[model samples]
Target: MPAGLTVALVAGEASGDQLGAGLVRELRRQVPGVRCVGIAGPAMQAAGCEPWWEADELAVMGLFEIVRDLPRLLRLRRALIARLLAARPAVFIGIDAPDFNLGVEKTLRAAGITTVHYVSPSVWAWREGRIRTIRKAVDRMLCVLPFEEAFYARHGVDARFVGHPLADELAPGGDAAAARRELALPPEGPVLAILPGSRRGEIERMGAPYAETIAWLAARLPTLACVLPVARPALLAPLQAALSAAGVDASRCRLVEGQARSALVAADAALVTSGTASLESALLGCPLVVAYRASALSLALVRGLRLIRIRHFALPNLLTPTPVVPEFLQAEVTAARLGPALERLLTDPAARATQQEEFGKLHALLRCDASRRAAEAVAALLPGYRAPNEP
Candidate 1:
């Protein structure tokens, strides 16, 4: 490998930031002095990535939101593409921003620059036609889920299942007692972790319902203590307002900024907005009920268009052979339904045991030293790149 090989990376959101950071660390370990540059969040920047743009610029979610920001996003993409074309990095990795990165990747790959898409778009689950666009966009598709690699291989796309970084970060079993100690919670009492969602949009849709669920749980279980883990500080005010409006006692709720994993580990059960948090709870061995509510138009459009191919949306159910946790969506996401589901997980020993047992298997399947594998896969695309232990 060259002495100063420049590797460009673009991560769209917080999760991608984390994945990018891990990949950066592993790449640095294997190939010293590798220059990493592109759109990054704090984590990626902390791991020596030169941030050309803040990741939050491309962090917009939902079809409507993206449409609203389309012009700005397009301009950002054009600027990024021009810069990359001029710099001509050895490899360009797009981390989870398919809408933005795939276009950039396609253009760069056409220019003879090797491109890798770190997280495969959910083409396998929905919008299977995207496979065609992905084929042209990336030289390699690095998938976190096992099923994704199979889907790509069947379609003849060059792909590898590098496993999920979260699985490697969180083990099958967690020390609930230790987590409680860290959170300064009573070790013996019932605690619920409420994760409405990370995005402002998610909080807007889910905060009230989640708070209501918490209030319902508190009413049922007198000793119930709640922990709300806010991904961003901005989410805290809205969450608190929702909880207060729901008549939930603020004194009984501990609103903590960040430390989401710790809250998951410490809780007896969690009421989480369906997305990555469901997977995190499962990985942490925390049984949870997943709930999601989007804008009425968004849900209607998704249902009207038949966009979702899969029956299940939660990560745990998607990964598992069968549903291991309950999922409430749209109108079904009421506290009357979610509260009972969470209550069952918290109170029923059999349910908790079954979930933990399945979580162990899920963990084993995904704990494949993901960061190292991702780095190795990226390195293989570079000229003169050799494995660290190769002679």
Candidate 2:
């Protein structure tokens, strides 16, 4: 069969790449021999996308960081728009990365191409004004959270609660033994997994203190081992340097390229940096202590940003709006504070079990099977787009 429709999908970061990969697989399954192309990481490439460029290079975070890289990003985006318009795909699917994808999508939509933004921008949080921009860009918005549907409806943006791909991907049970063996962990001791995020800026700002917190906890609890899962080896150099500079041994920590699922599943508890990891940790049934720190400028920008309805940050807590996880931010983040908080989470079996049970409920709520819904939404835009698994 020949390709009847073409899809240009753009996914800027690791999380977005994972979502994009899932969407691609579903698109192929639903509409076999669909031509997929655009900026993507390895996973999406494996799903049969001919990359216009590596999606990693497009990953510039925070307002200030993006400002510094604006000219390059703009040039890249313009080139992308041209290629996409030339190819004239049946639809353009922008997966997350709202700051970057939304603008490109807006341009493509104005040029008469059907546009779909896979993940809704956080209008439910800060920057509610962008809902209008989303309406301008996207014909349909696929929301991962249930509450997001109401949020979009209030803002007059078309949306569907398509559930989260993570819930579908994560198996309920964990493999602690496999994780321990893979990382050469001690067979009988409790383990603490540390995920400080994948960005370079995150490592530089929070690395030293996070490592110090690990060392502090290790000293107090002789039986506890620290497992630091590296998002990328490049992001780990600063962390490794911090361990060396602080007179701590790197041998005390295990560094991994990824396998965040394994690390979280194997751990008794986690010291996670404030993004998607906290959510993954919950799904893995790991109790968590979330932490984050950014430069004054970026932090200030975040502080000044006018937030709306969303009150919680972590997904587990956000889902229930209950005090299920601990989030330590900026000024409150200290080695002394973090270590004790981590220790407390580790020691309390009842609390940990309660949180895990809550996460299980959250998982069931989010396991509504998103890809087919998203594909159907996209198909609604094409000439004769038929959804294979229509709901």
Candidate 3:
């Protein structure tokens, strides 16, 4: 449509990288020779994004973690702002990394550059005050969840729900028997998928509790097998140490690298750290017990500030009218709590079917060709932009 049109993007973590990559591919298809540049990971780089900085540089988690790296992050943001302002791209899309990208978006928007935020921060759940900053920062807020569009509209922000890429990528009711065969586990017995989390901080907090949960479940079910999927190779050492400390038998548990979806598909139930993985587990037709423990100081700050607004933390629960999945947070995220919840899902057909039924409905609501919709929303922000099929 336009010669050498450039779209600037910043994706802070692996999930955002994936979202950015899909958006890049779709944007390229719509506008030939569109150049994408910003902080990107391998996926985005492979999708033809020229990275000014790697996405991992901004992948810090937790309040303490971000505070620890604040100076370096601030420097990176300033430099990125300067670069994007100078380059003057047709549109600047902040994929995720709201803390970093929101400031960048605000600055760039102030400079008259069209700005869009791809994945909304949890303003609807916590810190609703951020709506003021979001209104200033984003020309259009492209949400991945359906409910988020209405939330933003009530606040007078220009927002659109483009649906979720994961819904488009993963089919409902995944083949458990086939996935178990692929993972080399017995196709008959009850298998449990344990996804601690992708971040090191998450693993550090969740590893022990997850290991204990495995031990608890294994004691109750003699035929139980556990599949622990490490989101990255770096997490293996810590995960192994945790399992060892809990005295979980090595023979009963198998650790695979980067096959979270397959692990979820293979298992009867999952003990998932409350984040995107929990949603993944649900989407793959696996019932899950969601658990999470934030750093003490982070929890203290959130509590002191009264930042948290919602009753449910799990994505599947938040998406639906009522809580479809059980969630345990803070000190409640222990073997005692997670064990029984997972046990019910593993043993009771009714509980599993109930969650699975809700998951199927949720999947249908979100399977909206997300990347293409996001690309269209982004393109609409560009000057004199028109759809390819527009007459």
Candidate 4:
């Protein structure tokens, strides 16, 4: 390992952890001898990152959650900035998980460390003011989506679109047969997969309707097997309670913890609560009903920032908005409505074919080996680069 160049990276959530790991692999490939350190999860650590703290500690979501964790987040950011200033890493790469990464980038950039923000903040969606913050922090921006490049250019930020890795993985067509085999279930049966959400607040808000939707589907199609791939097991009891209150059997509902990808792969038609799962469902080539519900207060807070012009929230629909799948949001996120949407796709071959076609187009756009491109951008900023295979 070389002493002249060290890169400190911080990724706050599971998604960021994934992005960070890929970037580390790419960066290592470019500069095999460069020292890579700081807060990272399993993927980045596996890519040879030396972790200074648990990155999960910074994975808090939503407005109130941020406020609650503000002091700790600030303290962590200051500690990272101080260490970077003291040792002076040549470049600081802040992966997704904006709130945790942005301030660190700002402080480090002010202190003369080259800064790169690996993922653009949702400046295109809710916060227009973020452009100023991004400009103050990042020296270069690496964006996964194609649309983001234009946005960064408009704001005068150095940004590049390196293509999306999910696109590469899913472009080859989704494996429905393999998914069914892994679950040990017959493809003949009606399979309704429940993806509440990754965040606890989201799971709490969307979990009841999700379980209720499963119960309704199970009753309508008795042969239907419900698979709920839960994110936080702490909320599982409450979710099961919702199913019981609706007269749905807890035993019948197979709760598989940490099997989100498997659940998306196996389902005939998934009832996915909005967010990352929507994209995963599309990539898996599963026709899905997108349902999302937020507390009235949470809803009110989000409504305050109305910069979003996109008609579709689900990634599949957003990619090709020809009503490929039903998007039931807020009050429209009912079990009755979602159940039929899933049923329609499951029973109708024509409908599923149309969806599969659109999903194919979306997958093509996202399918680059994202980590490699991302790593190249980060490594290009480092000095004295060496390929990992080189002596």
lDDT of 1 by residue, 275-328 (tens): 888999999999988888888777778878888898898999988877889999
Model 3 poorest ten-residue lDDT run: 380-389
Off by over 4 Å in 2: 1-3, 305-309, 388-391
The whole-model lDDT of each prediction reads 0.90, 0.82, 0.91, 0.78
Question: Which portions of model 3 show Cα errors greater than 4 Å?
Answer: none
Candidate number with the higher TM-score (1 or 3): 3
Using TM-score as the measure, the top candidate is 3
The predicted structure with the larger TM-score, 2 or 3, is 3
Model 2, 1-391: lDDT tens per residue?
2347788999988888888888888787777778899999999998888788998968888868789899999899889989988988888999999998999899999999988888877777777778788889888888998898888888777888888888877755687888788878887777889898888888888888887897888788878877888888787678888877766666678878787778887888998888888878877778898887778897777778744456666667778646688878788788988988888877778867877888888888888777776766666676765555555
Error of 1 at 254 (Å): 1.2
**True-structure RMSD, every candidate:** 1.3, 2.1, 1.1, 2.6
Which residue pairs in model 1 clash with each other?
none
lDDT of 4 by residue, 1-391 (tens): 3455788988887878877887887776667577789899988899889998877878787766577788888888888778778988988988888877888889888988899998777788666888999999999999877789998998899998987766655533547568667766566777777888877777767877777777777767878776788777787776777777778886567877777777777777788877777888888787788877766765677787665556677766756747677898888887888878877876777877888888878787777788888877777677665545658
For lDDT, candidate 2 versus 4, the one ahead is: 2
Order of all candidates by lDDT, from best down to worst? Answer: 3, 1, 2, 4
Q: Using alpha carbons, what is the TM-score of model 2?
A: 0.95
Note the clash tally of each candidate: 0, 0, 0, 3
Candidate 3 vs 4: which has more TM-score = 3
- Model 4: residue 42 alpha-carbon error in angstroms: 1.4
